[model samples]
Target: MKFLKYLLIFLAVIIVIIAILAFVAPTEVKVSRSITIDAPRETVWEYVNSLEDMHQWSPWAEKDPDMKLEYRGTEGKVGSVYSWDGDPETVGKGEQEITSIQAPSRIESELRFLTPYESKADAYVQLDETGSGSTRVTYGFESVSPRPMNVLNLFMNMDEMVGPDFEAAMSNLKKLVESGGSSGETQSEMAFR
Candidate 1:
């Protein structure tokens, strides 16, 4: 009886500590990763700007090969959207729509996850010329969790969880762009800056 009482007290103390930590945790999280690709800025931009090509290089796509996908609007234009439904615990159900783009420089989109948990985030890809025929690509996501969800940050390391996926996707993008041969757009035609 003494041991049981002690155990109950210990558990209560632990829960209280966790609740305090969660209450103090940051409500916003951002995860970003970058890679330099040996491809023209425009070529890399073309690939990133196209939703159809995104699935070819995104790490999540490789997570569930059988994941169902739906597309709407034109492929690379603003308003273009891609929706996916898959394992609730793994890929989850989400839709991403291109909200804005600056051609070969930057692309921003709204990402809405609907299952396993519902959350919305801003996803972006920025391309910058790194000289010597290389382009630096930075891909990232930023999310602001509501107050209640902020506690999840105390237990979950957002950067550690999402950073690798971004890195792998960028690596895949580099491979896909460099080995696919030129995009047939000359320097003049490919210039978007």
Candidate 2:
């Protein structure tokens, strides 16, 4: 009886500690990476603005080449959605919808993960003219964890987890743009003209 009582007390203490930690843990997480490309902002924006073009340089796509993809609405404009279902152990499944576009400067989207876990994040690409013919591209995502789930943020280093993928994707984008390998103007780009 004494051992059982001790065990119950121990469990209660642990729960209280976890609850406290949950309240103290950060509720928001952000991860971002940037790369300078040897191409003009307009050229870089062409690829970044189009979901289809961006997928061409996605590291996750390289991880699961056979991943199934689906698109809805206009190719690169607001309200457009890009969805993918891939290796459950690697890429998982998710959909991203373009939320806003600021011409050659910024593009924002909402990302929803459906498998492995369910979560939503705001994703963005920012472009800055670095020089006469150079552009700096920043890619990032931010998510908020609510309530007790915020405790998970304490264990997750989102920057460490997603940074390398962003780096590789940026490297791929740089190579493609520098090689003059754009897949051509997307509907959004054409409309912007």
Candidate 3:
């Protein structure tokens, strides 16, 4: 009986220590990653700005082929929305609404995740033409969590979790668009106004 009591006490103490550490951690997390693409700004913009064409090089979409997707807006202009429902652990599911867009230059969106955790984030992608037929693309996201999780997330890296996917998607966008064979590609450069 005494041995069982001691074991219980020890386990309780360990759990308490872990909870305390998580509470003391930072209250929010932010991550940003960028990569320059070997493609024209116009080419890269077309891939990201349009909801329908996202499938061509989207790293996550390809992850779950059976994921349900619904899109809104005209092709890729501003006010477009992309929503998907997928397996919780693998893709969880979210809706992204393009709030502002500046064709071949910048796009900002509100991303809301509904599984694992419910959170909203501001996501943006900007492209700067570096000449030599390349665009320096910067993708960034900021997420804020509440209370204990926020502090715990500070110790964890959201950028690390999400940045690799962004990097690969951008790379694929560069290759697909510049190579000039994607059916979604439009002849004219995207216009922001």
lDDT of each prediction vs. the true structure? 0.84, 0.88, 0.75
Stretches of model 2 off by over 4 angstroms after superposition: 184-193
TM-score of each: 0.82, 0.91, 0.75
lDDT of 2 by residue, 106-144 (tens): 999999999999999999999999876899999999999
Models ranked on lDDT: 2, 1, 3
Kindly list the per-residue Cα lDDT of model 3 for residues 79-141, writing each as its tens digit.
888999998887888988888878869888888998867889988878899978888877777
- Candidate 3, after superposition: displacement of residue 58 in Å? 1.3
Best candidate, lDDT-wise?
Answer: 2
For every candidate structure, what is the RMSD over all alpha carbons to the true structure, in angstroms? 6.2, 5.0, 5.9
lDDT tens string, model 1, 14-37? 889767876798999999999998
> Which stretches of candidate 1 lie above 4 Å from their native place?
1-23, 181-193
Which regions in candidate 3 have their CA more than 4 angstroms from the true location? 1-24, 183-193
In model 3, the worst 10-residue window by lDDT is 184-193
Best by TM-score: 2
| Winner by lDDT between candidate 3 and candidate 2 | 2
